[model samples]
Target chain A: MKSERANRRMMTRLSIFAVAMFGFGFALVPFYEKICEVTGINNLIKPAAAVVNTQVDKSRWVTLEFDANAHGLEWEFRPVQRSVRVHPGEMIQIEYDVRNNGAKAVVGQAIPSYGPKHAAPFVKKLECFCFKQQPLQAGESKRMPVQFVLDGALPADVNTITLSYTFFEVKGASTAPAKGGVQG
Target chain B: MEAVHGHTNDHSHDDHAHKPSGIMRWVQSTNHKDIGTMYLWFSFTMFLVGGVMALIIRSELFQPGLQIVKPEFFNSMTTYHGLIMVFGAIMPAFVGFANWLIPMQIGAPDMAFPRMNNLSFWLLPPAALLLIAAQFMPGGGAGVGWTLYAPLSTQAGPAMDLTIFAVHILGMSSIMGSINIITTILNMRAPGMTMMKMPMFCWTWLITAYLLVAVMPVLAGAVTMTLTDRHFGTHFFNAAGGGDPVLYQHIFWFFGHPEVYIIAIPAFGVISQVIPAFSRKPLFGYASMVYATASIAILSFMVWAHHMYTAGMPVEAQLYFMYATVLIAVPTGVKVFNWVATMWKGSLTFETPMLFALGFLFLFTLGGFTGLVLSIVPVDVQLHDTYYVVAHFHYVMVAGALFSAFAGIYFWLPKWTGRMYNETLGKWHFWLSLVFFNVTFFVQHFLGLAGMPRRIPDYALQFAEFNAISSIGAFGFGLSQLLFLYIVIKTITSGEKAADRQWEGADSLEWTHLPSPAPWHSFETPPVVK
Candidate 1:
């Protein structure tokens, strides 16, 4: 009888040992993962403030000035002093001061996408005017501009077309980036 | 204790009678049959739920251009479908089989920990609920794909948190279950049933459990970092905050790669058993098969970066991962060769189970070949995240793991339920799934080569015809599973009687003596094996 009791105890101890071993197994890999995170071997996530910047590469530079156009159509391209001779592969920056001169806010989305029929190859986006959703407060304005490289491989025939965008208010405007340059 | 084979007056069955039927019966149950039934049914329900999610995805992907859902909702479908299939469908199905067959095969009375077995299985339902609940959360559900990469997942909404919690629970469940398997196989084999004498299924699962215990926690930790990065302000992945996003991929694949093996090992176990029964011979290279399985499990840990080769890893890291990925072909090739050798000159017949096993052998090896091609560094450069990758995984998951599981279920149904499934309908189900499975996925390889990608709402016109054909096949495959549900139900409700040795070629202890349609409580008193 005592031996039978001892056998039961032995089984119990064995079972506990088994459970402990597996528990150790279960916990060990995750502990390694935690170590990976601490040591940054796993490179876990970290949050930070939003930032934006731009610098011009002199080799790939062209400039256009849409100097102070105060009068135009209800919906018109702000006139620019242009007709400049740019090499087939020269990148150009279009700088313009844009505004919502109307009484109500003007809202719009900027999609910097490739081509009329997949015609333009989007080399890359350095900084897009579309990063933050834009809504011009009533009688508000801002400088909405873009800079892009015309990859040296741009075809010679497609060199003279005007690259343009039109900003129309979304039915119900919600963001605050559109309050840039309207004089009260 | 309940008598295993219902001879309560015999000395071997002494003091083993009268099983309690209420909840306490389960709480304190040591009966392998009872535990097995619980596992099989739980896995079945999870399969049905996960299946419904698959249909939702197929229906939306049926024609592209955002037919029935928004992009976020679409992302949710993809995420949940993967998560559910891995955890809810495949893993649970293997566990169910393990609970039912491991003890019998080893000639043991019960698993090592009876109470913990119940707890581990029960934990599954709540974990499943947490995953399903994420769909209804404010942000719909997790949309950063199933890998849940760092900055994208960390910046994701509350849905990701729920996914993390769900992963934690699932990992715990797998760990617990793995431990139970290890202990049962290690300590409880009958006196003469040494490691070499054990059945192939038991051998395969023992290795599978080792893989599971080692990796599930790695998964838990990967998700935990995602959680803390979001809530605790840690910069583990945020580059702006001194964290590198690529590190998340490294950590995740560390666990994720082994996870693929964890799912496959049990399926390998199932197919190993089924092939022999149908082949009318003992398994060839039993020792070699065991060694190969162990080798595959170890290699799985080293080859994870193959998945990340396209994430802009350094050239040296890429080369190391590439060669390591290719090395997998050696052991995996050994397994296929052994399976074929077992059937080489033997009297082979195609039972439903054997057909699925054969299907798994042929197609999984095909998938592995494509995997070798994919592991090549230059080839992966173009194929990563493309339709090619989708085809590779589907071949393994659906054609390989899932088909082997079906073979196992059909092979063992008679022993488990004491009823014969209608062979005619079983054949029809098999053929339909085979035909449709090939039609759907076989064409995806070409589309991938031509640069079609996954997770897209639309595609170029050149890829349209193949996409449409694949969609139709997906629908057919989806519909065929209903036939499977019908077959299972009809067998339980109305099939004819099953014999003690259901299959003449069967050699395992499961068929050596236990009656068909195992009792509600079985094997409370251990059997002696030689």
Candidate 2:
């Protein structure tokens, strides 16, 4: 009887631990975001607007290469410019040309990531079409503009950054506006 | 003390009653031994089911070019195969060992909560059914790999929901089982068996149960989120709704990395027991072995992102994960070294169990080294999602865990059944498994290095030759397992009776105190350990 009581108590404690760990798994979502926000690992969501300091680093020339891909969607998507030379901290603008080649209209969401992921924090976007869903009609072509400034604090050893986007078809997204205008 | 004495009196009285007959005996059994037997048989059935799926995959890959199965069907096969083998086969098999052996080893009467023990085992069948039933769902089984990366998983058919539900059930069952184990070990050890003096197998299991308690819920949570995202308009993994797909990888691997150790630590316990027994020596570095197992569990939490290196984590995150992953080799190496040291100057015999242990040590280490190679960011970038990754895990999972399981079974079958197995057949099973296993996976390393990706229905012309060889090896390996089944069945039916101490060098209470074919009621009056 004594052993049974002890066993019951321990079982309860262990079950509680299991329950707590399940909550911790959900906690990991916020925990992961916090870690990525601080470490700048896979944090592609645009950051809050900072004070516009008109300072540009003239000594470093970084090549910004743009790449675009469409997955399981009938669309022609590519960067208007393959690459651009920009000074660190200089504000720049570029466009990606996308056309819906299929007969029917479609919705797409562009997910972006920075290569050499160290540059993700420093490459702040001022305006970009990737911030929302894009709806394109048959034969409709659009030039999506992206405006961004690279932080002067980017490490000296880093000289190139690849900004890539893959467009995925969004089901049931046709209810939203065809052109959900840019946030900026 | 009075309560303990009263319990003994009650059990003695209860032992004389007529036992439940026929199927009711199994269906209503609250006995640990009965539940343990059920768990083992269930796991073996899943092993065969999963093995058949693997052969199907291998046969299709023989000549490449989509000859036998469609690409979508191939994806489903790979996904279900991994899920079944890992969750259905390996995990439950080890749990069966714990249920059967732990109380006996510790000199306890039975599991702390036998009813819960029964519940846990019973939960497994429905879960297994759900997993099998997934293949017949309207759109077929989940094509999303067992890893179930988000967006891909989110886009899957109705079967994905079934898969998610299956994971939840499996996780619940594992959690309850772990709770039962932790409670039994902590509260039910015989008087005088201190924590430090407990058998290494018990120690390994204590840690493994803790790991299960910690990680199974995390897996439950991940799948729960997958469920909500698919049906409840939650954006846990949908980027458009502010959830990041990479976040899903982080959450899954958090559960996943520890999961590798969950399957392995008990195998370590099995090897630790077998090596010392065959060598006629006490385990070398018993204290260090305990510490090393604990360290491996601790470090598992830190290295999860290694599985996601190609998913575009930051340079610093990659470097940290890589270094931490490589660091696991230290404790793991300590374990291997100690196993060797235990056998160095001691009398050694090559029993079937020992052969499997040696195979585990040699092959698991090879898998570990390849794991180290893949830990580097550049190498993983090249090898990620390739056949090399497939080869690496199978080495660890199949050669490492499955082989050790085989060793444990061979080592303990005599005690469990009171019968001696055919030595000749046992050795044949071992050698064939060793050679064919290597033949099947060894060439996969080359295929991976040559840039052949995994999970594809067909491959380029260059991969044809090695794939054919691998398919042949796979068939050989599959057929060899039949010998194991035959040996087990034959031993149970008619074989030489086993002595109380089944192995000459075994020192555990189960071997020394219990009679062959241990009675239904073991340690009714708990034996005091010294």
Candidate 3:
């Protein structure tokens, strides 16, 4: 009877440990998000905000193209202009129009990426809608502006640049402010 | 103890003489040996099934273009092959070894909970069936890879649901099995057989059982989240709904990394037994081996993020994980050194088991070195999802775990069956498996280094030649297992008779005290250790 009791005790203890580990797995969701928030790891929307001023490379014209994507959100998003030609250091402006097609109010955040990955450091954004979360009521439409200037030293071989923004719907509590640098 | 002895004495006639015969014997079996035998047979059947899938995958990659199967089916083969092999074949095989040996080694009557052990083993076949049946589900098996990272898994068809359920069942089985092992080892050892005095195999299984109980539920939770995300419109992994996909990776790898050790540590236990038996010496640094195995298990938890380096992380986190991942090599190195030192000055004989053990030592080290290489973030980013990663794991899995399993099977066959296997056929089995295994997987490192991504039906012309060679080796390796099957059957039915102590160096309770073909009920009256 003593050994049987001991066996049951051990099994109970292990079963509880296993159940606790199960909770720990779900707990990792929030725990990891907090780590990402504190550490800025894999937080793609947290842009590195830097403004570089130099002589405009008027001699070399770099073609900049804009693209927009809405991932799994009931929003119609598009860039107002398809492409623009600009000098390397010229501060240029572009617009994107987003319309919420869903019945309920929705909050979304935009993440930006560069065409040639190396071009990310060279392009500077003076003001961009991506710096904040956009909340729109049902059937609401809004036009957002993005202003940026390329560094005069962008690489001689780089003649073309493409800037892309993808908007993702933020579920649950969207009260927290968008993360990272906000110089607007 | 007297009452326990009385109970055990009632059933300890000759080998299986008092046991019930016919199908119902196994169907409702409470005997440890019967359950262990069932586990071994089931694991082998799954091994062959998984092996055939591997062969199918290889034959498709034998050429430069889509030669035989569609890319979709190819993806399914790779996915199911991984699932079946890990969950169905390797993990259960080690459990089989544990069931067969643990009680006898510790001089116990049986597992602490014999009925629970039966349920655990019986749970496996249905789970395996669910996994195989998943492939035929209306859009084919879930090709989200074995990790089952979400977004892809959520978007996958009905087959993903089946895979999730199968995983849930398998996890339950593993959890129950681990509980049985832990309780058996902790509560049921013979009088005076303190924890330290128990055999090395028992120690490793104890640690391994703890790990299984810890992480298997994490895996279940992950798959449960995936299940809910698929049907309930939850966004646990959908980035569009505030959930990040990388969150899934974090949780999966947290379970996944430890799962690797769940397979390998038991193999380590098996090798520890086999190596010393062949070398005719006591194990070198027994305490250190235990410490190293524990250290490896603990370190396994921290190094998980290393598996997802390319998935993106802060440079500091990357560096931290990178260093933490590399730190595992220290404990692993201690283990490898101990195995070598075990054979340093002893009277070594290259029996079939020893040959497999040596092969495990050599190739597992190679796998470990490659693992160290992959631990460097920059190097892993280059080799991530490539055949190089493929080559690394097969070395660890096939050569490391599977080879060790083979060694244990050969070493214990005589004790289990009361007959010696044909030595010549066994040697042939070992040599053929060794050569063919390398031929199959060795070139995969080259293909991976050449930038051939894994899980693809076709490869670029540059990788064509190596793919061809690897496929040829796979067929050879697959065929050799048949010879193993034949050898085992031959031994069980009509091989030469074996003495009580089949191997003079096997000094455990099973060999020292129990007769050949260990009695249906051993240690009926508990054997005092001191």
Candidate 4:
């Protein structure tokens, strides 16, 4: 009877420990994220918003190249303008055309990449079509606009930045593309 | 000299000793020996299934072109082979050993929880079914490696769900089984047997059971996250949704690295017992052997990142993992030293059991050395995803754990069956296995060094000759196991009757106190240790 009591007590304790380990496994998710943030290893966290330039820099001109890619998606995507030259403090607008070529409607999400990667923090998007998912009807075509200003604090020696957007097909869609977008 | 005690009062219940005949006997049985038998048979069956998958893989690589299976099916073969062997073969076979030997070794009447033991054994079959059935589902079995790194695991088809569910069930079974073992070992030892005085096998199992309880649930958690990510739109591993895919690797190796020791420590226990019995001496450094095993288990957790060296981490983290991984060799070296010291200058016999244990020693140490080579971050990155890594693990898994299992089986067959196996046939099995196993794996190291990657169906013409030789060796090794099956069957049915004490050097309670073909119920009154 004494050993029986001990066995039961041991079993209960071990069971509780096993349950805690299961929780620990899930805990690893948030714990791993926190470590990544602290160590900046695989940090996907966005950089803090930069201070807006109060004074316009009139002397510097940077060339911006617009590029669009449809990754494994049945869509025709291209930028309307090849490139634009602008002062660091001037806001500029560019348009991209995307058409669903498939028989059925599809949703897409766009991701942006920058060349000379250090320029990423200096270029800010004020208003962009990529802020939300775009759902296009079969054979529907739309031109979406991106508006942004380069920070006047952009590195003085860097005179060119390439902005590219890649669109991936989202498997299911419940939202419509931008309303009142310019038709190309 | 040993005394045969009066156990007249030990057999208090004739009903408990009486074994029922038929399928229901195993279906509803609560006996530890019966459950142990079931575990051995189940693992043996899984071993064959996983072995066939290996042959398929070897066959495809026999000539450096896609000859038999498609690329997808080939990937599936590799994935399932690893899963089946680690989970379904090596782990359970040792549990089988623990079941059959622990209660007898520690002078317990039975496991602490007999009904729970039955539940644990029964859970394995359905889980195995789920794993095998996964291959037939739409979109084929998941080709993600056994670690099942996510994003790929999340995007894999319906079969991935089946694999995940199977992993969950297997984790549950392991947890319950470990709980039962821990309780039985801690609470049921005979009157005079202190923790320090318990048999080496029992001590190793005690540590292994704790490791299992702690990590099996973590594995369940990893798979559960994978499951939710697949269906519920959780971006736990999806980078597009702000989750880093590398996080999955971190969580998996956290469980996976400790999992390596869960399979090896028991094999160490087996060798610790077998090496002494054949050498006709008490184990060398018994206390040190226990300490080394404990230290290895504790160290297993800290060095998981070594497996991910090529997966990319900060330079400081890489350096830390590299040093920590190589540090495992110190305690592992202690175990090897103790086994050899047990044999040094002692009168030795070359019985089948001793032969296999020696084979485990020579080959496992070789595996350990290669593992040390891999621990250096720069070297591992160079050899990453290569046949060299493949050869290193096979040495550990097959020659290390499987060979030790063979040693334990040969060592204890007489006690379990009350008949001696044919010595000549067993020696034949060992020699053939050793020869063919090396023939199959040794050249793979060279192939890896020459820049051949693993898990591919084809290789450059430069790697062709070794691949051909390796395939022939693979077939030879696979066929030699049939001879093992024959020897085991012949021993069980028709071999010569054995003495109550089969080995002169075996000093465990099972030999000194219990009769051969250990009774259906043993130590019921608890033999007092002196």
Q: Which stretches of candidate 2 lie over 4 Å from their true place?
A: A42-110, A113-124, A132-145, A149-184, B1-18
Q: Which digits, one per residue and each the tens of the lDDT, describe model 4 over residues B1-530?
A: 01222345346456444667689889998989889999999999999999999999999999987889999999899999999999999999999999999999989989999999999999999999999999999989899888898878988989899999999999999999999999998899988988888878999999999999999999998899889878886767765455667888988999999999999999999998899999999999999999999999999999999988877677899999988888899999999999999999889999999999999999999999999999998889999989999999999999999999999999999988888999999999999999999999999999988889998888999999999999999999999999999999999989897777899999888888887778778888888888
- Model 4 chain B: lowest-lDDT 10 consecutive positions: B1-10
Interface RMSD of 2: 2.7
What's the distance in Å from true for residue B48, model 1? 2.4
lDDT value, residue B530 of candidate 1: 60
Q: Count the backbone clashes (under 3 Å) in each candidate.
A: 17, 0, 1, 0
What does DockQ come to for candidate 2? 0.48
Q: Candidate 2, residue A67: CA error in Å?
A: 6.8
Q: On a 0 to 1 TM-score scale, where does candidate 3 land against the true structure?
A: 0.89
- Off by more than 4 A, model 3: A42-65, A70-77, A83-93, A98-162, A167-184, B1-11, B14-18
DockQ of each: 0.04, 0.48, 0.42, 0.39
lDDT by residue for model 1 over A1-184, one digit each (tens)?
A: 1133443454465446545544554354456557655544332121111222223333443322222322221222243434344443444555555566666655554323233322234233234454444566656656655554444444434434344443333333354554544211
Compute the TM-score of each model's chain A versus the native chain A and list the values. Answer: 0.45, 0.78, 0.70, 0.75
- Pick the winner on DockQ between candidates 2 and 4: 2
RMSD of 1: 9.2
Model 4 error, position B263 (Å)? 0.9
Quantify all predictions' global Cα lDDT against the true fold: 0.73, 0.89, 0.88, 0.88
Task: Enumerate residue pairs that collide in model 4.
Answer: none
Q: Rank the candidates by DockQ, best first.
A: 2, 3, 4, 1
